[model samples]
Target chain A: MASRLRSTYVLPLLKQRMEMCTEAPYLKLKHAFKDRCVWEGTVEPSGLSERYVVRITYRLGYDPQVRVLNPPLVRRADRPIPHFNGDGTLCLYPVDSGEWTAADSIAYTIVPWISDWLFHYEVWMATGVWHGDEPKPT
Target chain B: MLHVVLLWPTISGMFLIMCAATIRTGMGEDAMASQPTTEVSLDLILRGICERLQISQTQHDLAEERYHAVGKWLDAEEVPRLLKTQVYAQGSFRIGTTVKPVQRNEYDLDLVCEFNLQKDTIENPVILLNLIEARLRQNALYADKLERKNRCIRIIYANEFHLDILPACPDPQTGPECVVVPDREAREWKASNPKGYAAWFLSRDTRPSVFGLARVEPLPDQETVDEKGILKRVVQLLKRWRDLRYCKDPDNAPISIVLTTLAAQHFVYQNSEAAALTAVLDGVLASIPPFGRLVVRNPMNGKEDLSERWDDAAVYSAFVSGVRNLHTQWHALVQRKGIPNITAALEALFGEQPTRVVAEEIGQRIQRARSSGVLGVQKQTGTLTVATAPAATITPVRPHTFHGK
Candidate 1:
């Protein structure tokens, strides 16, 4: 079994990586304690005019959570926003697919996923279709 | 400061691990990460809308097949006087600015059938018009399709386009390409030069040298989408705007010829279609003469007034108001910033269905790029771009389907 990455090892790496990203300068670590950390930032996806404020919460052992803090996501007349959890956090990737492991960096994975999610969300609003990748049925 | 000094060796060890992590990500096949932002321009969206507006290849082929058949039938020597008559296309059909009808499928095509007789050879203008109508009536198919108008013999082809055939005699005095056609209302032969006008428009529609070699005129109805010049696209967009605005009051609407002429005249070479359209709009608004003043003259025959119909005070005012509305809406469209706002503005100007269809198509293309693993995000903006070459600072997003409840 692969050993879980320590929070001490993960947190500093996350901060360093986020600092290196010149594009997402607004994203900053707001709170860090024990094995949990939270980040807040704003992103405007290319081609979309709306700016969305995003909040990310991550604990060492739990799945990372991302939520749109501003411009509350609205459901279409015919359907709800696709790939969203019951609690309203985005389902950025398949949990069982091993696409995202605990070893992955939140700055590199979760922060960018938020932008990709919002991009598709706008596309969904226009087309009423979820254009993002969906997992295959077993 | 004391802690930093004490942990320096251990911190350096972790730094090496972080470097290893970075290298691992760099070498990994699926470094799906952030992407640079793709620059979406107004030119891209407008071109996409025009792509949908252009007539399909199947429709073009059918229009051509039918056009040739009619030309052959008219020239089959069915009428003795029309032995040397030539049938040819005119208007948007020839100039490649034809816009598909918003609510209907039937395109209005203009054709001129020039008889061998000179202007002096025909005693009356009615005689030439009657001869052409009679010859078409001889054929059972054409007789059923024929719908007589004041100036032209109309032949309906059901759901397809109907041809308006104007019978004329060569006007050698004006020019070789000029012809004198019968006007039933005026009881006179009006000197017109459709052939020359088309040639003139083509010359004006010439591709700029920057776009490389001059475009060879395609066969009638076969104009490809990419080959359309910025001026032609400007004309098409204007025509579509006119059609949607005048859906209920088509009779009072300014004709396509006036719009085409204005666009071609004021057309400054522009690399961006949006800029070209803006320039044309500004030029047209500036050139709209006051009521009863006729400034828009045919480029080919200076005597003919293209704005003659605007002679009526009501017609002139209506056209000016309609153009003003178009000008206002177009400005509003350009001012819009976001995709939704821009799309809403486009729907307001071009109609909802076409705008939505094109926007969706553009969305699908971006989605396909994402699925291909080439999608990257700009570290600064958190926007998407194609990761043509993977850079250490900017990482490619890993491939994963969007899934969950």
Candidate 2:
């Protein structure tokens, strides 16, 4: 994607998404899991079992509009909003192993888009709707 | 990419416009960006062209047709009642996500069947796989996708969805990294973390994020030593990040090996510190849910980047390192003669005693893959021959190429 075009439209789009509410976990996810950050909270309701909802907040970084080839930190705000949700519940279950593909990463950009193909699933799971479809093979 | 803290309103407006245009635009460019319905085809290589880009959309329909066709084709001939019952045992045969689309000769029949290896009857995967291959060879739509491996079946369709049948064993025993993921969850997560370590893998090399639930168990594609190596690395990277995101002991929730939410958390956490970890966690929380990327950042340079949030950066990195270290050590131990199988690896890495059934099941899988050519069984004499028969496009990764460190 052209950085210039992304900057012209993408940035304005992200800045606009931020609401006045500070409780969003955008800042929190970073606070808890930054390579340097260390804090602990137990997941009262393990997300695996129903009854878990993820919360999000934002304190996004600005894009320099530079064409970064391996830029030190090449993340964009329009990327999916990272929730600092570990706030009340510290122990998150199912830690991610870091292996993935480039196309897989496109989810970050699509995440910023946040359309229903994906997040609605979380909404349902959190709200506990549409979860019990027949016990799927584990 | 824009870095907006709140992008919903604008997103809605733009997305609405996109949805409107996508209806006219075919494959839903915005839909792919938002709730993508990407299609996969047989071409392993994708060329640059507007038409080529849309191949993903077409493959979905094609796969659906082929699967239904195969089922009917199979029904015509009288087969063992067991095969009929087992063919769609846990779930039906479905087309999976498309890999990069090639302008010409795209990889076809990128299909997969969902079967839970960890939780299914021991005999089902074994019998079901063999039966399907024989069944499919009769159908013109899917006849080409079938091949034999002693008893295992390898299906290479003429179109999209080159499927390898195994069981969906989400158990972390094979490697805590070998996490079980739902197709839907896997799809969503792939779109969520573009450019993180895992996403990087998507771009760096030809990596099959995972086999559809079908190929996960019963028959561990023995030819997958190369595939296994890559999967092991991916699991290591993702698991380490998972540890950082949750602050949960990796040992405690080995299942996280397959969880996408943790991958999402680790992504955000590794990116920032003060609010980095918290913020990432928050983003995760906000995303409400998910299933689950890597890029190398220099340690020193990485620290400076997180200088403002150095403490959080170190902590997250240490957690990541710990996961990586463990993954690396175990991958090494698992490949040895006696310990290479999933059961052995599990025993060595997690210290969990695998049941005789699990070992036997895995052994049978290895033998099947060896005979079929998907897996190259290393003989006691040290010669290795793949059993997964050349009916599929599976490539072998040379041992010399593996760092195995």
Candidate 3:
């Protein structure tokens, strides 16, 4: 059902990737690629829905970007790292460098990216240092 | 005369042996002779440790804010206006002995939502529970967050904290003051008086302040610090030890109320926090029989037994053994006279984080004192001493005296 809504190019790659990942059951793609493609999922192991809502919106345009929805992620005093924008969208990578492109699968790329961000965020909260490989915004 | 002379040496020899034993145990002149050079006395350190164990002011404020929010949310036009509702906090938060949760980032607040309604009108326990649930659902904020449990409605705030709101109706048999809360699992109403229990605990805190120190002033807009005696501090310290020791399996670990009730029962007002703690630990350890069952009852209400949770013998034994180990370590701390020994003992009891914080704070104080020239070091022994001005450069000649008369 979710595959019917997604782009033909994106859906096959997602299906191939979902078979390998354990987190596929918790994730769902809704209203894919027409008006706005929405990814709804649960971030597990932490398992708290309020703290880490996995609802994300992807809009297809000249410059494609992903926006976080549901729970707004705010910077905490303890973390003090700039990983998110004033808008709820995560500044996952440098957009100017074309890190994410339309050819990439949203499920394979964006979903895993969000999970990695959350994992690093928790580590940052505890240790006050981000150990992730992503380049932080100056 | 000859017999008396022979016995005098023996008596003198016994006295010498007693004195030697006292010094060896570090309980006599040797213990008192070496005074601390640093401004950080044991009392100050103990106070610092207690401060570390206490729940932060932010946590207290957030809990209060949430509780008040719930009360406000309940008083809506959709809810029935026939009964007056009131909220009261119970358990450690009420008693002023709440320790930081060892494993979790959140605190657990136990609250009761008492409604001024006669039992005749709301006859069934299920009806009372359903009524409260219905009212909570009316507010959009609580609709998704509410969880109906065996005894209370748990509102989980995800990462922040959860409030266990136990609904109650005024008990007819116990007059207007007492209330009966539902035991949903049993499908019956159980009698509990949180206010009365709290009052009894407060009354039992009759120990005089050992340090005669002013209460630690709370920050602006923070909750007022409760009047703390040595008993309260000991209770708090023991609770912290329990938390750290049983963090992995906190459910099977001894509950706070049981520990509090037992310690309060055995507590004797002492002149120092250390003494009070040692005495209470000794009291609790002594009361637990090695072979038989342990029964700790609530002092306020005879009907309620606090030790009901200690059902598993192995868990109870582990608790008893853990407390005994702490007592031995505490004794080692008392006898030893150094920062390292004290810190190690504290680390063993509380864990690494709090002990490290306290050690750092003391180090800072010593550093400040040293930089100001208030602290001096003896060059020969490298021992710390209070700084003093040098004697006058010119020595004055004095007359010699001969012993006479």
* Candidate number of the best TM-score: 1
Ranking by TM-score: 1, 3, 2
Tell me how far the alpha carbon of residue B276 in candidate 3 is from the true structure, in angstroms, after superposition.
1.3
True-structure lDDT of candidate 1: 0.70
Give the Cα RMSD of candidate 3.
Answer: 28.4
Worst 10 residues of 1 chain B by lDDT: B1-10
When just chain B is superposed on the true chain B, each candidate scores a TM-score of: 0.83, 0.29, 0.75
lDDT by residue (tens digit), candidate 2, B1-405:
101111111132343333222111111123222211111110000111111122244454555565555545554547554333212211111211122222234343322232334423443334445545666666575565566543235566544454444323233342332322222222210011111324333332344332211233322222232232232333333333343334444333323312332333334312111122233333433443222122222121221121122134444454345545544544453232221232243333333222233333333433343233233211111112222221111111111100000
Question: What clash count goes with each model?
Answer: 22, 149, 0
Q: Which candidate model has the greater TM-score, 1 or 2?
A: 1
Candidate scoring better on lDDT of 2 and 3: 3
TM-score of each: 0.83, 0.25, 0.58
lDDT string for model 2 (A1-138, tens) is 111111122222222222101111221232332212211111111111112122222212221111101111111233421221212211111112111111121112211111111121222322222211112245
lDDT of 2 at A43: 14
How far residue B198's Cα lies from its native spot in candidate 3, in Å, is 1.1
lDDT scores in order: 0.70, 0.27, 0.57
Candidate 1 per-residue C-alpha lDDT over B112-131 given as tens digits, one digit per residue, 9 for 90 to 100: 88888877767777776787
